[model samples]
Target chain A: MNPKFYRSHVLICTGTGCVSSGSNNIKSRLTAKLEESGLQDEVKVVETGCHGFCEKGPIVIVYPEGVFYCQVEADDINEIVEEHLLKGRVVERLLYTELGTEKKIPAYSEIDFYKKQHRIVLANCGRINPESIKEYIAVGGYEACGKALTEMTPEEVIAEVKKSGLRGRGGAGFPTGLKWEFTRQTPGDKKYVICNADEGDPGAFMDRSLLEGDPHRIIEGMIIAAYAIGADEGYIYVRAEYPLAIRRLEIALEQAREYGFLGENIFGSGFNFDLKIKKGAGAFVCGEETALMASIEGKRGMPRPKPPFPSVSGLWGKPTNINNVETFGNVPDIIRNGADAYRAIGTEKSTGTKVFALTGKINNTGLVEVPMGMTLREIIYDIGGGVSNGGKLKAVQIGGPSGGCIPADLLDLPIDYESLQEAGAMMGSGGMVVMDETTCMVDVARFFLQFTQSESCGKCTPCREGTKRMLEILDRICSGEGREGDLELLEELGDHIVSTSLCQLGGSAPNPVLSTLKYFREEYEAHIKDKRCPANVCAGMSAAYVIDPETCIGCTACTRVCPTGAISGERKQPHVINSQLCISCGACAEKCPVGAIAQG
Target chain B: MKSLEELRKLRAELEKELAARNSEGKPKIIIGMGTCGIAAGAREILQAVLQELEKRNLDVITTQTGCIGMCEQEPLLDVELPGKERITYGKVTPKDVERIIVEHVVNGNVVEDLAIARLEEGGI
Candidate 1:
């Protein structure tokens, strides 16, 4: 008998998802309470990494009796402590209620969200202490590099990747093995492996989280790729915007070098590989492969034409293998586990899981990696926990500015590279922003176009001139000056820009305009024909707020908080908004004591 | 510098620990102390659980886990009983420690209203 020493374990989620939601405070409070109650010595509290089911956070598990709690709040703490801790009674109200059932689940594994997920790349993400190198090593972190260095030849390594059917996750679904083979076969003495960490796509943080949660895994993956391609040096081109990820990566690299996993004849293998970090100056265009390489060379980040693709002649006029943070992160797993094992997860063509930074109007707005064939419905509904604020799902923007908007009708479509492209959207760097019915499609199109227009290098006439013209037209339309031929003019200019642009940045710049036109033509018609923004998102088309006489509670909260001196009324009387002076900032609506304010 | 074989051995050892506890009738409790949980007072609940078990000298093991969704609920706790069902308690407080110990552990009867949900077979 193990002395009958108190038999329960409390597992707390220390993943980024929970951290953002204030899990740290909960941990500290629980610790203080346990110590005060003299219950600290028996049960041990361990802070683990991310659990894939990020929708329900600040999750706590009581062992021996698997009790699962969802949406745990601080105010409800004492009840939990008194009812469950002291009395050894499970707290039923705090239990996670299944969608259709009264059955309260007590274990993490029983949740439907967790059951479907086969976590591979993200296996250790939520399970270990991210800051501790020993914990990473304890989970076979650098073993894949060891296996590749000691056992597999360069060709064999490439062959395994080729067999796995892993594709580039940085927007374009280029085959990873094919890209490596190209660099390997290229006759260049100074081959380089570059990790594209300049994740500038709006609302995308998959790369950042992966680096923050498990930086060593990416390093291990890169080392394997460097060995496979016979590259002597590697560079991680990350944006300066991600200070945390950059710091973590630097630490991880130092740890790897110290452990003999990086730099000079790694793992006793004859192959020597070293990694360097290059900071990007936050240019959106720098996400392009050529621009990323140029930035590393201490030049202004700008895209160059293809045909001298990075694999053949890139980075100081030498052969280079450029894989994004996600692509490299998958390499170690492919080698550690067999390629056949990976190939079994995703669709036949697009094998393995793809990581997405699920954002916008989704309930579970965090990092998610699912098999390639998982439908948008599963991602948005089951994993993302449906549209946020109980709003109707309108559209999903995939692949950032370079990708297109996918309407809700195509929510059931499998989320493979080809399927997304077929639905007029691309898997551009795994940024999936779920938009709701309140979003204005016309406004959405304008926003992305403005981004690309500003980010364009202006090296090409088509993209520079064409994008500017389209943006001007969009601005006019958004400002309620749109004419009947404006939509046609946008399509014509978009086609011209896409056809004649120098590189992918410029080439795919018109995707947002083209896609929004393809799906939400009515919105465009309303903007041009009816001159009204249906979603009330376009500020130019929206009217100022006015208080209804019946609902006004005579509270001066709205009048007091209004930034503009637009509302005028005596106390205890309904206020009338002067439209000329009104800014339509919605401060009055928010400050309204009674629900009297309405905006058109 | 540890070799690949050494790293593999370490991994195997860690995995062994994770798998070893389930062999016994002792129940395992996993506390969600993810970033969200920690922010929501998970640390307090964690300490409370430990102190309670230590005071009673009960044979329960406590481990830390990650987020299980439901961001609205923080400081979540999962309790597994031997030969019986698993229950999750949400919004746990240090003050609730005494009640949990008395009603759940010694009595073998669960506090149903506060229990988040019950676990199915083979569900950890």
Candidate 2:
């Protein structure tokens, strides 16, 4: 009997979010307190990865008891040690309460935010120590890699992936199995497998979190992918911005090598496979496969015209297969769990799960992985806890900056590749930015158009010039300088750009503008015809502010915050605005406690 | 690490260790300190718990974790004894620390009213 055997396990999140909020210091304090109290041997401390809800970082969870504690600091460690650890008492005042709930929900799965989520790619995230290979193996991690190498053949592996009906989770819904099969079939002496971790979507963190939380899973996935395609060497092209994810990957790779998973003949089967990391130098367009290959090649990181697809000739002119991080992450599970289990999860056409980064005005904004067939309403209202601050949902911006804004009417649309495409929105890497009623659709289009316009590689004239022209028209319309035929001209130019663009970046750039125009034409009409921004989001469209005499209390708060000093009044009397001097900044409106300051 | 047989043997060995670790025979306490937990003052609550325990000169194991996606009822904590059902207490403050220790940890009695969740015999 081991007396030193710990009875309690404490899991603290060492994910980037929690670490930023000083979780490391909190952890050290806990360790010190445990040592001081002579209770060090009974408790085991483990630092796991992100628990998805980053808003309440510096999080802590205790096992068996299943208690949840958030935002722990060094200052709070003493009381926690005294009351909870020493006395075996739970602190009553600091319990997490929502909607004034009387009871604490200790289990992580039963929480409202996770009630609807089906985590597949995110299975080990926040559950295991990302840096520990033993912890990874404890949760049936590398068994897939072992299973693939020992039990299955190269062709059999690809066949199983195909039978699973898994599609590429990267923007394009290309079949993963087919991509592997193409590279496998193509005649080549040496081949390569690449994991596209260049997740450039602005409002997305799914790939970054996946890499950070479970790096071994990805390594296993890539190893399986490499084995399937008969590829010996691999590269994971991760963005330079994701330093935490990168560091974890480096650690995981070294561990995998030590564990005899990477860089050798696996299980004495004579199949050789290994990998290297290529850091992307911050180009959004490099997310494209050709551009990514070009970057890896130490070239200018530009997309070339595809006649010989990457499968036939890629990365030093060898047969290659590229799949997104999430796509590859799903592969190991498919092989281990069997094709039928993966197939049964989602709809007939689209199988397996999709990890979405849910950001923007929605409540419970976090990383959510749902089966492919789940409706937008379920994602927004059920899992997301509806719009934040009691606001009405206006639209959901799917994909990246270039993805479409699906209106509230289309919330019933199933979140799959084909359905989203049919609805004029590409499921481009699962960046879902929710919008409230206050968001101006015209301005959103303009914002996306500006992003696309600036990121154009200038390889094609239509994408370069056409996106700029569309951006100019959108800017003019937002600035209340629109002509009658501006919208029509934008439509015409947008169509031309989509058809003629060389790469996917230039091609999909107009989707935001087109989708917004298709869904919210009335808002555009208001901007052009009535000279009014209905959502009141556009700055120049609505250019005046006035003090509502009935609502005003002559509060000096607004006067103090007002940059132009346009507001003036005596104490206890209604304030008057100097209209000539007012900059229409709406700072006073924000500063006013009452509904006194009105902007138009 | 090299062969399938070795892998299976290691699996069995690790499984035994896991079983030993999970076999419930002592009191345990878990806390939800995910980002949601932190925002709800879980840190202060955690610290307060430690202080209270030290004052009583008792022994316990306190740990924290990321959000279990319960943003609404965050800063949640759970208490379990050697054989007692796991009881979850919600909206806990430092003020409620002593009673939780006295009524629950020492007496093996669950602070039922403060509990949000429990492992009931019949069903959840």
Candidate 3:
């Protein structure tokens, strides 16, 4: 039988980032416009997953020609269809221009943001229609599950993963094959595999993107994991906040079941396995294995001490194996291409590519996957297109709230499990948030402390009370109410919290504060002793804006722009800002015509 | 649904459907969709090209182009093959699409009666 074909394939990204930026509207308009042109039969509009260049979202790629149009709006669809699709003339206006240059990148592969990325897990993300099972199959999606089930033994599969040096991408960097082996070694009839999709990091969306973009890859990975661990049932603990991810996963599960990939006798190998998605109530701590398993079992999501790890007792007291979304997303590729192929990409200890959610003060804010040994400078400067607004970079906060801040001097540090840990930051689910020079270090520490403090399950003392104490000190320092030796006191308390914390949360909760203190100690000292914020970020610690009488020119620009009646002077005289009425809002300073305003 | 062979068979069928996007080296059929081409019923020519390709199970990449500045030739179709010169057929109708695919594309023989011009190589 002949298959349907189109002259051109218009791949419009419908991932959450593009969807929020109105890619769906753009897609519908393109489809309607194609029909109007009477070329609907020849032209096909395909909705795929996240292209990862989320900074320039609503991305449209015309295949066969491979013309990449970014930041496309619904209104631009007509021009794209009429000019490019209909006429074959490339749309020059919609092309993505290179950063700091007028050169337009007509092809998607030529974009700097994608040029450095090694997308093993995300290979099918922006390429295929995620909702269609046929598309997934055509891309050799479930072939790994079949290979693992039919060709390789469960022990062989575990050994392959172990040989590949695959680690848990859920921040801990524990060996994934070891965890699977532990579960398989444990004596249990009913074993389970869980994919931890409950990603709650502030700037982390790598897991969510994997789930939304190519969910079947994750499903295929989980099936292989279940077969390895001798499990027939599994659950994916995804947070409720990810509505789009959840919806796509639901569709993938239904489709997989229909194709006999999820139900009994998958691939006719008699390896009966299935999956269920357990929606978390959006607790950050549930990302922990114990807390995740607890939440899945209909209990309050709180972390329990290790030793009786999930491998021995988890999810209604069964030996279970769990991995992160990206970890599972990488499994199928590893199985299909063998352990040696996977081991060849990354560093010795941390093999395969790691997906990072690149965000915050960066020019290209998107999801990027690079090999393990790539330097921070490469990911941030080369791929991220440097800091946004041309601002000088101050630091990069990795591993979310539980991670530490790496100062600008350490930008060349090679990113691997041991290297990041040695630098006081874990590979915490790959949330790399770039901080510019304008960001106050003390405030950043305070912000992370506030997040961990509020999200604390309150079951432990060090996390609940200790985080609060550290937060108070940070708040005092930011608000210009800090006392002498406050920095030393924070260090002492931070050490105590690290020692006394029950779970990983409390143990690593002081990472941001401690690391910032270790690196940017002078910033903390200036905030405390000088009663000033170097970045002018803290409201109470902002330096007073004083008008320089010599340069003020008496233009009354400062007076008119000031919200408060602070600036007062005659039409021809230099303006005098009443210090008492000044809110330190910098309006008068900005409005100074002769460049007279200065922060006193 | 049950066997590995069945899975492979299904995958093979689906891969053909997505071949236009994945295949690299193949014969291409470029239809002029410029304003002039559309007015000259190029839309019908495009539909006919797709139908002829599907009818013969031909693995050809069909794409559209904008105004080639040949308004008098209303509908223009360009066939490009690897290591071959690009043949431009002007004033093409829906009926000529099949013969062009069969005689020129399949048999490797240009229909001189309809062929108007030729470019050496890498002509869009």
Candidate 4:
């Protein structure tokens, strides 16, 4: 062996967030510096996957001494090389300053943001060479599959998963082990396992990141599932929007097949399994398991009623087991590490860590995985680095269209199946969109309702007509034309739609509307009673601009920027905005230089 | 192309080599080369480090890794000098490479100002 060569390893984030921030230039500059200094021989640099802390990227870490450097720029390279690399001194200014304390911490793991996170499904995500099959193998990649094939029987493998209490990471928190068992016990000559990668929620990218960062892990998980369920073929129903994820999945499939872990696999044990990629056309409705299966079958994606859930009969009328990218991603770990180890991490009901695409007003806007029982406040403030812009927290929207908005008052609620359900929200595919005080609650409800309304397949009248009518009421209320009973109508219609719709797409469509009504009813009442939007978010209810004479120089800057000629004033005088002609596009507010514009 | 058994044997050999190195006090240096890291120019820095080590015939091993979430600082370096301390150098450039080797690796003295942080008694 080459005598212990380099003393330290440096990991730089190359995930999507860092790539957009010019991480590549920093890599080249670092290489050039290292070579010139002749430390290239003693030092090593490796670019790894996303390390989850996206708020302060592009991130850099040095380990076995884990020193985290945040928001470093290209010009800072010389100081790092000259002072730290050569003189062994840390640049304190470049260190990540914790929110409450001014003290500079060195190690990456000790940072409060990562201390609470339990990374299981994301174990190898930011740590390994994702593209290198050799590196994956070196880290005991296929060992789980080998063990499953060589040692354990299919029944025993299934039993272990059942004991682990693993649930589907896909929006609906169904039991993964039970789903597999149902497909296994069902009467069918040919069975299949489908991994859903068509993650369509607005703020969700957990599935995409998993596929890109650790494609092999998902593949291995699928293979294990296939072996357990007697599945001969598998399909990864990925969305066409994720080109990077698709490329990685294809590469991973090829590598798995080459290793004999897939495609007539055997560790001297007879079991056959193969996986294929099926791209979705980016329809939000296709995220539904039934519609997703239909899309895979070369049919116009649409949902079919239950009783014969995917486990009983699905995907070309076979006993098919459907699991999302995250669910499949967990299989290998569960198998290799044992069920008890996996179960020991999370709450009694919801076992293991959950991957969340924490976006919107949160400081850390990338993917994060915390244990099941972690409170929303912990996720937002502790793991997510708190709200961005130091804005006051208002509400959080969990579970996308199928879920509801949780108010700030309930921020301390622990995130689990039962707790979130009781709080009028479901952990829908782990999409946590944090909102600040500036966000209008009524507008938030309307936005999600609009999303579901447009994406509805229009198959049943309750969903098709109910969503349309609900959206119209929301629009009227937001536009200040709401009647005295508009709120009652919304609540009544929302319940009707939720109870009468055909599939989950229709059934859960009214969550956003109902949840907002339940929590922010006053905002709705204000639109009708006071003819105003409390947060000044509604386009129709809010006026364009009110000039503050104290600050306005009468430069007519607002008039010039306004698309409409609503502002009238001479040069160097305070302008008067004509509300009759103002469109409330906020152009005048944006163009105001002296901080004279106000909108309400 | 090799048979499955042959591939397995080769994998075993590589594992053995890795295990032996890990057991010894020879600190292993991993370079982030994920898509984010590569896009950030980690490839070039990785090559430079390997070439420099080859020229000096140092008893160090180099490997590529994935992103570590700090994309702003690409081509990052982690130095685990034997018996001393492990330091993370960020925003590294090619011009500063030679000085790192001469000052840190050869002299048994670590460059202070450039380091992002030092791994102390407990892991970071």
Candidate 5:
């Protein structure tokens, strides 16, 4: 440490969110102002990756004090440097207000969003400079790889991981250690280890953030796995959509090779393990380990039958092991902190922290890493600050298209493999999207079905044809062409698809439809029986919004904003909406001065 | 960096240097100059803070960072005493800077009204 250097460090997030919002200007302005005041040497400025608080980007974090700032501008840098940096006085206006709190400006943990979170995979995300190998080394990034390769035998490494009780994070919840053991025992001349970075879930971004924020951690994990499974080569199958993650991974690979962590004679232990990055074609089905391996082998991405399950036959028909980016990211922590330490964090069944991307109608929409078995209610109301716009929460859709929609009543459902499975939801890459009362449950089901239907590779007879038939039923019901037995038909198709599917993609394809049917059958009944959308959100619903005669106070307020001029009335008189002219745009309802508009 | 033994030695040395930098003996302050705070008039509040501290001849380090995910309550500030729990203040004005310094910094008392977030559990 240089004696003339700054006594404090200010980290600004230049991640995609902050950069687009002008965090670069904030950095330069902060530096320029500090240099002018002769305090540049006393204060160091570093730009880091995404802090997961993208909603309040242009985030600034001052270390030692650890005061968090959000939505910063170039104009605010001068004040921050002058007031908070120089005078030993905090600038009250720049502090972040804890979500869901009445008055307290939460420190990082006090923020309910972060209180339940336990950082393991995201241990160094916003804390260190990913581009700097030395910064990573300072925080024990590659120490796990060293420990695994040098001291621990291959069997000892596997045993430690098995004891950690970490299940797969890629929705399946398979044991990571068991997978490695299967591959190790499989007879093969050249075994392979592949990191499944093809995160294709609709709202999922945890894998992308992990890969971008700490690429070395994943590389270290892969290296340690190679040493454990006695593999010589590894491949990282990442989705091409994530350019930033891909770039960082590439940079990290080059740096690791330079540092003698990769290539021949790693740590001088003579365990030569090399890695290659393969950009995926953005196929959702390729997220399945089999399909991902097939894609890596220069073939079409499609799911194949298991039992010979990657462990026995994978990636050019060799004994290969596959794990998601998040699963591998946890390996380093488990190695560094020991299995018992990791096992102590979560429930008996599910161990360690799970990173969740909290999005949709929640107030504090970002990424949160909470321990396993936290209730949905705490994650939503306490951490996510309930629904945005002061609307009541209708339901939370977790685990993407293959996962299930947990209703508002089951808000206390503990988030774990067994608990979530019983609730008809799976932890699919940790996408927890909180939906509000305005969100139509039927439409949500239809939207998920549509995503799955399009992403289906059509290799299996059940999912390929079953999803099409179910989607057609959903379309008819949504467009006001519903019959009495359409719901039953959907249930039957879901059961058949789950039973007869060839792969997990085919097997779990009916989750959205089945879950929505089981939990929200009332909404479907209303759509069919009353021909009305209770939320009035569906476009083709028969419900027409009308102004009540008793409530309409002769106000022509709705007449002006009506795009189609469907509302007609004179000044100081009750207005009527012509059903023919109304496009059901809800403009008159929105423009109504009184709470008179009703939809039924 | 080549072997495990060398790597462990480097880690110890680096950790020592890092620890020395964060001795907890020096007073520090931070401003939440993120997008939300900036939009909520934190720039001026920050200026007032600097002017107040400068007027009092108080020496401390100040810095800015992105949002802490609490955009609703922008214009945030956190004060760190050597060994004491960090006290965060919210919705501060140029006028509140003096009271925070006089009461909290000088007299070892926290202004409860302005004190918002406490940073004892998770500092960074």
Candidate 6:
């Protein structure tokens, strides 16, 4: 044992959010202060992963007291070292205050954002130093891998996973154990296991955080999966955009190799497994399994028909088992603690937890892992602290561009795989973007279609042509040039694309348009019929701005600020805006002294 | 590296290093590290106490405090378990650190030979 102990441990978040906010400087400054105060031996500084309260980044937490500090700057390091680390008095100004209340929360666990979260996948994310494999081992990291390899047979491992009701968390809710069983039972001289860390969904960073925070956990999960499925070689297909995740994963793999966790070894049980990382060139379609396999095989990343699924003929024409990063992250926990323990956490069907990257117009924008079947309301209001800027929530865009928009009326809906699919949204690798009343639903549909349309691999006609057509109609609608029956045309095209597309990329591409049309159809109608955007987001289609003469003070604020010089009035007199010259910029409306602007 | 025993040994070896990071609700051993206490050799006592806890694999929080107006017994050590009254040992040398941790922190028995004062249920 090292036999070294510190009175206090200061864990500074070095996750991407915190690093971008200059946490590295704060860390160095803190180290310098500790050395200056001669408390270097007594106070240990640890760099951790994302704390998930990223809206207040540069988070610092001192253990033995668990004082939670947020938005810490380099200058604040002196106060933390002097007041908290030295004198044992918490710096009151740096504590995380409750969203609506003035009460300061010092402890990390007691915060409302972290209290509602059940962190199984993200258990070690912000708690440990990610760079140290020793810290990972001390937290019981690879014990499950050792247990699976040394004690249990491959059949027993697969049986336990099956009994746990573990499903694939990579958007599709396929049973993971069944996939493993297929790959294990297949006849092949050599087999392969691929971890799909190529998370390409817009607004989703669950896999990146897991890879950056606990790369060893994912590697351990892969080792167990490889042993279960009788695979000797594995590859992690992560996108190249995630440099930090890749670096951490590289470090972890080297450390695991050094510890005999990887390579032809096996606690002397005679099993051989090694992994290599394949970086995808940032293609959204490569997230699909076949496309990912094709990319790994040094071919163009495009999906082929299934039926001869990866379990039968996968990478390099061998039997392969592919699972998502999060799906694999759950394996070690399920094996260590029995299947019943894993099944007990979530609903009967969707067992265990799901990690969602909560973003958009929410008060707390970060990552959150909640148990399956948790209500959207609980995730949005209880954990996310409701919509941002006290705005009314209009809808939530779940599952990325391939997913759908859920209206405010469905806020109480329990978020399970089946329920999300029933609401026309697949639980897409867990991206929950809350939209406020100021958001235009028609534009939201257009935004997602634009993303999917641009990311389409163009392998099939339905996805290529169909998405183009839908996006064109959406474009026309938002630009105030929409014709009647455009909504019906979009629905027909969406159904055709969903039914005829070759891969899931094309199949689910029209989800945003179809789901938004299903829920907020009236908004689309208003765009076409009234020639107006109710939310005033579409600059071309927004209702014309007019000065309310009765309330206009003619303070000349509007006239001086208007770029078009449309407002004409005298001092203390009512102003009149030239409608033709107004341009609907709303600058005059914002600049008006009195409440005198109206959309006419 | 070839067997489960190796992994377990590795885990056991590093477990004590992380014990200090998770010391909520655990018994606390506070060493008076004030200027006067440091002059009386309090830093050595803190090191000895931490080493003993690590050797025995105990979960205890060790902290430092300024002097409490008892410079005569400068190197003071206080042990306060959860819901237990605080026990302070005065004039503590590096040699007495292990016995105090074993008796007061682990076994819940105060060392009578080094008895000094008893505070209320709460800790500083």
Worst lDDT 10-window in candidate 3 chain B: B16-25
Q: Please, what are the lDDT tens digits per residue for candidate 3 over residues A481-559?
A: 9999898889998999989877888888999999999999999999988898989889858777887877878988888
Question: Highest lDDT, which number?
Answer: 6
Candidate 5 regions off by >4 Å?
A1-4, A99-106, A548-560, A568-575, A593-597, B16-124
DockQ of 4: 0.07
Model 3: lDDT equals 0.89
Ranking by lDDT: 6, 3, 2, 5, 1, 4
For TM-score, the strongest prediction is 3
Q: Kindly list the per-residue Cα lDDT of model 6 for residues B35-94, writing each as its tens digit.
A: 788789987887788678767778789777777889899789999988888888999988
Give the docking tier of candidate 2.
Answer: incorrect
lDDT of 5: 0.82
User: For model 5, how big is the iRMS in angstroms?
Assistant: 8.2
How displaced is residue B79 in candidate 1, in Å?
16
Model 2 chain B: worst 10 consecutive residues (lDDT sum):
B15-24
TM-score of each: 0.78, 0.84, 0.96, 0.82, 0.84, 0.95
Stronger candidate by DockQ (3 vs 6): 3
Model 1 lDDT tens row, A241-318 = 777678777887888787777878677777788899988899988888998899889898888889899889999989
For model 1, residues B1-124, the per-residue Cα lDDT tens digits are 4456766766655543233224366666667866778789887887787668756655566666667785567778877777777778888788876677678866777877668878874675
Q: DockQ each candidate and list the results.
A: 0.14, 0.11, 0.62, 0.07, 0.13, 0.49
Candidate 4's residue-wise lDDT over A79-158, tens digit each?
76655554345678889887778678787778887788889888877676577676677677787888787779889999
Model 5 chain A worst lDDT run, 10 consecutive residues:
A1-10
- Residues A540-586, candidate 2: write the lDDT tens digits: 67767899889888878888987888889999899888977876788
Query: TM-score-based ranking, best first?
Result: 3, 6, 5, 2, 4, 1
Which candidate, 2 or 6, would have the higher TM-score against the true structure? 6
Model 6 stretches with alpha carbons more than 4 Å out: A550-555, A569-574, B31-58, B64-76, B89-99, B112-124
Compared with the true structure, what per-residue lDDT tens digits does model 5 show for residues A293-386?
8888889998888878888889899999999899999999999889999999989999988989999999988888888988998888877778
Better of 2 and 6 by DockQ: 6
True contacts kept of 6: 0.55
